[model samples]
Target: MALLVAGAFFMEILDATIITPAIPLIATSLGVEPVDVNVAITAYLVTVAVLIPATGWMTDRFGIRPVFIAAIAVFTLASLGCAFSVSLPMLVAMRILQGIGGAMMVPVGRLAVLRYSDKADRVRAIALLTWPALAAPVIAPALGGAIATVGSWRWIFLVNIPIGVVGFLLALKLIRGGPASAARPLDWRGMLALGGGIAAALIALESVRVTGTNWWQVATGTAVAVVLLVLAVVHLLRTPHPLITLSVLRFRSLRITVTAGSLYRMVITAVPFLLPLQFQLVFGWTPLRAGLMVAALFVGNLTIKPATTPLMRRFGIKRVLLVNGVLSVLWFALLAVLHPGLPIWLIAVILYVSGALRSIGFTAYNTLAFADVVGDDLTHGNTLNASVQELASGVGIAVAALLISQLTPLVGGGPGAAYSATFLVLAALLAVTLIETLRLPRNAGAEVSGTRIRRRDR
Candidate 1:
């Protein structure tokens, strides 16, 4: 079941960025500027993020099995739509449909895993789920570059067809979820406000990142987003049945991941986004070459999987996060010093370590998040975590893009200088998470991790 969910997770995440390398080809084929086609990607991410708050409701109201299978079918059909798109509008529409499917698919699947799994086994279950996040982004660039180089960019979407079909069949055979007997009514006001706020904020951030978007529009969007988000929070706190139960956030273990852990996710996600562009624009490398270099991160993420659980169980979540956080900050700083003249092998080594650290850090937070969130709290906790992670994925790229744009001129140099500055700034921001980690109890998350015994024996 976990494998089935992970496969779905991989396909969903893979489709998100596979078109990245094909952006130029897609632009040429559709008769638009490359920058304009970026909407297709943003549309998918924003739609997914905005709708994720409703995952728990969907699963509860519709029953998880029917909803999950429908999501697969929708995603499969949407992939076909994306492949056949004739223009930018068509592609963006298709991407939005894909988002609708994904908004239901992965998180629902994860909810099933979390809901059914034994507490003692959550570490393994979450670790299984974490790999898609680790492997998909790295693979997408390299795979997309190869496909776009050899064939039509449409193949990127076409590739999802078979994967989705297989996943659909597996889901039918394996997934078992029934609707809650006493599901609460949806909080329409909270739903509208939260989803609207997320959409507005993402648009504002993306617009700010773009070179020529009007400041008045950006300001208005940001203001509206702030208003809606504030309203959403208030409604969630006071409403009979919020889309997501805000009370679930009172769990410190989960709250830490939602706040500091999310920041770390956003910051780390930017590395992949920035590295590919930096490689092409600065090092004058081919897309394929740059992508291949980034694969070193994948290698590291894969190789380090075995040790993550053991390390956390041995040293506990607080120490693991603290060490990983400190190292990740230094890793970003190391990336800040990268230059075209640096050896390729050295760069690969650096990225490899970065990926290793990334895997460990993410797996730690994900596992610990639900350690203390048992029973009914698991539903809202899972939904909230999934939503934040989705939002972080989109915002990370936007934030990276915005930072580069603002820093490029300030550096008074070139793309390389701007990139260096961006990495340093991100490192400084990442350092902030460590402060939060420092305040956590030494034995935090020890129960699910089995570190309590280790600490006692020592």
Candidate 2:
């Protein structure tokens, strides 16, 4: 069961990261600029961001098995469509559909695992499930680059088809059907407002990059996004059974967890996106070389996985997070000092170390975030965290790209200057997370049940 669930998790996350290296190839094939090709990536991420909030409701409305199967089908078919897309716009549209499929895959699959798993096994299950999410980005760029170098960029999308097909079949056969939850009224209004707000905000951010931050356009988009967001908040406050269930916010530990989780993910998000670009644009490395270099992140993540649980037990969450967060920030800052003259192997080693530290830091954050939630709130808290996680990732990448785009010209497009400036900025942003980490209670880690959930918990 864990294997199936983890497979699904890996597929979703792998698709998200794999497309990064393919962007340049995609651009050339479609007769579009590389930056313009990023629209496909952004479209998929934004679609996931917009749709993820609704997954819990969908799972409740439809049985988990059916929903998971349908999600896989959609994602698989969309991957086929993406491979066959003849133009950039067509590919972007296909990616949005793919996003819709992926949006439900992780949370719904996770909910299934959590629903069935015993309390004692829940944390371990979650930790195991998170490996693919951690590992995907590590291997994605290298894999994507290799595929693109050997075949067409279309192979990246095509690769998902076989995996998705297997997943769908396995899900149908192995996933159990259960008595459905009583249907609660869907929060249609709340969904509209929340979805609209998030979509608007993401579009606004993307627009700032595409439209050069023209005051009028930026101001108008920002205003629209703010108004939509405000409306969502107001709706959440007034609605009976809001989309996200605001009552989840009442858990102090959960509150801190979600807040810190968002900030932490935001910082982690900047690394993969910026590092590859830094290697290619700054150090004049080929896409494949840059991707191979970036694979150090996965190495670190993999190496640390065996130790994450034990380390959390030893140092505790607060101390672990505080020390690790500071170290992670320093890792980001170190990139600012990297130059073309530096040995590539040395840089890879540094990144490898950073990746290990980052993996430990991230695992700690995720485990601690849900440590305090119990019973019904646990489900809602998990849903809310999933939504925020995706949102933070999208926003983080957008923000980093926008900043780097602006800084590049100012740095005279010299070797490593733009990359240095961007890394410095990211380091500064990460430094703020140290303050957030301190907000966790000293004994918070000790309070966690540290139990793994089994199939019956739901």
Candidate 3:
């Protein structure tokens, strides 16, 4: 089941970002400015962010089997719609439709894994689910770039057809679940408020760029988003049955994941998105070459997985996170120094290290999120975490795009200096998470990691 959900996750993330390296080609195909096609990307992201809040309710009202399978079908069909799109509006519409399916697949699928997996093996289960999140974004660019460079961007969507078909068939045989015995009534007010806030927030972030940004639009969206989000938080706390139970956030470990862990996620997620574009645009590399270079992340992510469990068991989660956090800051600083003249192997080495640290951080944070939550709180925790993760991913991409655009001019060198400055800024932001991490007790997540705290530590 973890593998199944992981596969679905890969498909969802791949579809969402497959256009990243091909953005220029897509703009040309649609007969529009390259910047205009950002909407197609943001549309899908905002739709997914908006719809994610309701999936927990959906999985409970309908069986997981039904909801998961339906999502796969919808996602697959929408991919076809995206392929056949003749205009920007048509592509954005199809991507939005695809987002609806994505909004359902990940949260529902992850919820199933959480419910079924034994507590003793939660680390293992989370490990399985984490790979797609780490690998797909890194790999999608290479795959998309290859397709676009060799042929047309349309083939990117077409590729998902077979994967979706196989996944749908296997899900029927492997998945088993029914609606919860006591399903709570849908909280329409909470749902609308939360969903609206997320959409507005993404819109506000999406509105920012280096050139020709509508300041009025950004301010209006920001103000409306702040109002809606506050209302959403208030209503969720007061409602008898909120769309998502905010109370689950009371757990300290869980709170850290949604807060500091999300910041970590947002910063790391932007690296893969920014690197390829920087290589192609600034370094004058072909899309295929740039993407292949970024694929080094794949090697690093997987190669380090076997060692992660041992590292956690030996040093403990808190210790591992602190060390990794320090190294990540250093890693981001190193990334800022890249130039076209650098050796290819050296660049790959830096990316590989980035991937390894990312894998470790994800495992530690994901496992920590569930370590202290028991029984009933688990479901809501999973739902809330999933929602936040999706929002962070969307915002990360939007912010990275904006930063690259805005910082280039302000930094006063070129695209190269802009990317350099962005990495340094990201490094500074990650350093802040180290402060939050410092506040965690030494033995944090010791249960999941199976690390024994020493008497001296106590």
Model 1 segments beyond 4 Å from truth? Answer: 1-6, 24-39, 85-90, 110-138, 165-181, 209-211, 452-458
* 1-458: candidate 2 lDDT, tens digit per residue: 66888998888888888887777778788997555565677678878876887776787787788888899999999999999999998998999999999888877888788888899999998888978876787789899878877898899999988898899889988776453568677788888888777777766666665334666766677788799889888888888887886678787767766777677777687687777666766677777887898898778878888888887777677778888888888888887888779887889888898888888877887787677678987777877877777778877777777776677678874736877888888878888877767776566756562433334532
What's the TM for model 2? Answer: 0.89
Model 3: C-alpha RMSD to truth?
3.1
In angstroms, how far off is 382's CA in candidate 1?
A: 2.0
Off by over 4 Å in 2: 113-131, 178-181, 209-214, 413-415, 449-458
Task: Give TM per candidate.
Answer: 0.88, 0.89, 0.89
* Per-residue accuracy of model 1 over 307-415 as CA lDDT, tens digit each: 9999988888889999999999999999999999999999999999999999999899998898789888997898788788777877777787778877887896787
**What would the per-residue lDDT of candidate 3 be over residues 59-131, giving only the tens digit for each residue?**
7889899999999999999999999999998998999999999999988898789888899988999999988
Whole-model alpha-carbon lDDT for candidate 3: 0.85
Going through the candidates in the order shown, the clash numbers are 0, 17, 0
